[model samples]
Target: MNFDKRAQLIRKYDVPGPRYTSYPTVPYWKNEPLSNEEWLQSIHRNQKHFSSDDVSLYVHLPYCESLCTFCGCHKRITKNHSVEQPYIDAVIKEWQLYKSAGLEKSRIKELHFGGGTPTFFQADELVRLVHSLLENQQVDPSEVEMGFEAHPNNTSKEHLEKLHTLGFRRLSLGVQDYNPRVQKAINRIQPFSQVKKVHELARGIGYNSISHDLVFGLPKQSLKDMLFTVEKTLELRPDRISLYSYAHVPWVKRTGQRGFDENDLPTGEVKRELYEQAKLRLLDVGYLEIGMDHFALKEDSLAQAFLSKNLHRNFMGYTTQNTPMLIGLGMSAISDSWFGFAQNKKSVEAYIDGINKDQLPVFRGHLLTKEDLVIRQHILDLMCHFETELGVHDSFDFNLNVLLRLKGMVEDRLIEIDGNTLRITEEGIPFVRNVCMIFDQSLQSSASREGVFSRTI
Candidate 1:
């Protein structure tokens, strides 16, 4: 698609919407006192029907030394290193809680460390954490995948080497942008040299799937800025690239997005162009676009997953693995049992308190209904593959009004509808979120849209 055509589509389709990381997204979750005991039961119940008891694991280390004003993740900004051991211990205890609940024998096929800065903990501390989780467990390196998010500024050579030794091969760096003006605007001031050095160190340690994260539509971002950032990124030749739209949702409390003047940020077609032009450069360099906002080399597992139509997504975003159950062990971490969703307490202190009391730290959860499960499948199909086929026997009777709503999109060439099958056009990839929102019964039925989600461009 040309820049002009994409720009025109942006005007027609850019609107605030959920990214659909989960269907019946968080806001629609029936958090009206989820049963802690019932949640555990759901895990056992789901395991019975699921093909494998092996699960994916996500550990959220929510401590950061400084604030990145553009970040919206749940985190606490403090430079104190003393807080590390206690947090690590608490997470280990949480893992034990699940093991005691009868998951002691399940193999962890995937493990990911995500956070304010995963490298904030000492290398030895992280080693101890991984060791404890994998103790008495034998995992084949090829079958088990491990990854972590790293802040290039603070990630050390030891951090790279130690994690590689622990079976983690994927290293994702948050290189939001290399432009000084944009960096200053977002309050993340790592230099290009810093990122390059970290990249080289991780590469030297034999980390195979290195990914660089880039964001468009920042306060001072421009088409030139994006091109330059992509050019600098190409010098490193990362295996995967994530070009995310900088979601401007200052209404979200404590996100620190308010640090920048909203007026200075790009909007509408301008922001869309930043992605379109940068995408062209990546395509020219032989990178294949993954599900959304991500690209990978043809050889990377992620690209292969997309090509093979086996890609999966969860709270941690896209993944090469589609484990039936995801066990999250950390403060504010979320767990998916394929039948229910449970979240640990958001506060570090409270989470540790719950674990100390020999209790699950979950403060909120949602048990999916049969209809929700069917809707979830359709949404997943669209998000991962851009199309879905519905039959009359499908459990959830999709609303007639919902299908009628797609008339506009079909007329715009953003979608093609024939009977019960829906497919987004090649030109409509950027509007996937917008297209998904139409199928969102909660968002469509609700009376309000304010303060819920960011623009979908």
Candidate 2:
């Protein structure tokens, strides 16, 4: 690797960019309010298209015992456990709404429980929630992929065992950093001991895919600290590791990120080096890089998917499941029908109120235009497979200005354009987001100020 050349590229391209989890990212989602009837119509259309095949479900459990100051997810922090049952009831009610409204397909190909903290609820409550969602549905245990985000400090052995017994083969534990200073700065002081116990317990209960979530560019983090954290993490030998860049979105997540000093966070070349060094170490240790910020062993499904070119990206990051209809239930959860995107209300009160009134709870959404749909595919191709093909007589025409915008990146050797195809060079993998930005007409056409997204480094 050419260190000098890499450093120069990083300096030049390291700027605020969307992670490309979605083509028209949340901010650029047209700000269009979607009615319950429209949301159901989209679902009905998807049901017809999908036939009896299953869709994906993402259930957001927003309760957290405490705040992880560096977390950027939507969460409600409180010591009260009373909020659990009511929230679960509302979520189940919301799912029922979809079922009763002509969503004929109930078989779930994939189901994921995301934070604030999924294990914040008691094990029994979780069991009831899952059962409610799958009640009378055609869920084949062997065909389903189930997983959840777990906080090591709070996830009891029962939490692991119950979920495992219920067919959850994947588990992701948040281990941002083992360094005490870094943890303190982020207000997430979990020791390695706690992580080990949970990891071992999950493995003993037969969880096949265990993922550890780590972060770089956190407050007070350094190259040395990152190396040490990677070393400790490798000791665990998780099936997958997500080494994410700390997104300092204080304006959007004021209370969650304000505990740390901005100066303490690594920036620019320093932050880039942290990720590069860690990536090198992980690769050297038999972990294959899967898309951006994710590494997995050869046997992991994510790696297999990447190799087979069946990998997919969504609001839940990378996944082997590529269902056309992804139904998200709970406050602030976002659902995606191939043609549209909708988000439930962020406030728990409003979400439950709408559910109680037999409403869909979707407050906002975007119906993708023909142009938006075409650009979305190209961006997804770049993000998941690092290449995209455009045919001469393709039905969807890409913006000519987008191709013009790629001139500099192509000249810099970040990408290669051959005929109607574009491929990201090996040197351009780290700058994939920059490559995708060339096609982001929404961002290019925007008049917004800075700080809409984290730096691409």
Q: Model 2, which residues run further than 4 Å from truth?
A: 50-52, 392-399
How would you encode candidate 1's per-residue C-alpha lDDT over 239-322 as one tens digit per residue? 999999888888885558878888889999988889989998999989998788999999999999999989999998899898
Q: Evaluate candidate 1 by giving its C-alpha RMSD to the native, one decimal.
A: 1.5
Q: What lDDT does the true structure give each of the candidates? A: 0.88, 0.89
Cα RMSD, each candidate: 1.5, 1.5
User: Which stretches in model 1 have alpha-carbon errors above 4 Å?
Assistant: 1-5, 392-399, 418-420
Candidate 2's C-alpha lDDT?
Answer: 0.89
lDDT of 2 by residue, 1-457 (tens): 5888888888899888899877688898874688987877777776677675567999999999888889899899999999999999999998888888876456788999998999999999999999988777655666898999999999999999899888899999999999999999888889999999999999999999999999999999999999999999999899999999888889899888889787888998899899999999999999998888899999999999999999999989999998887889999999988778899999899999999999999998888887787888998988889999865434544546767789999988999999888999988998999998888889888886277988888
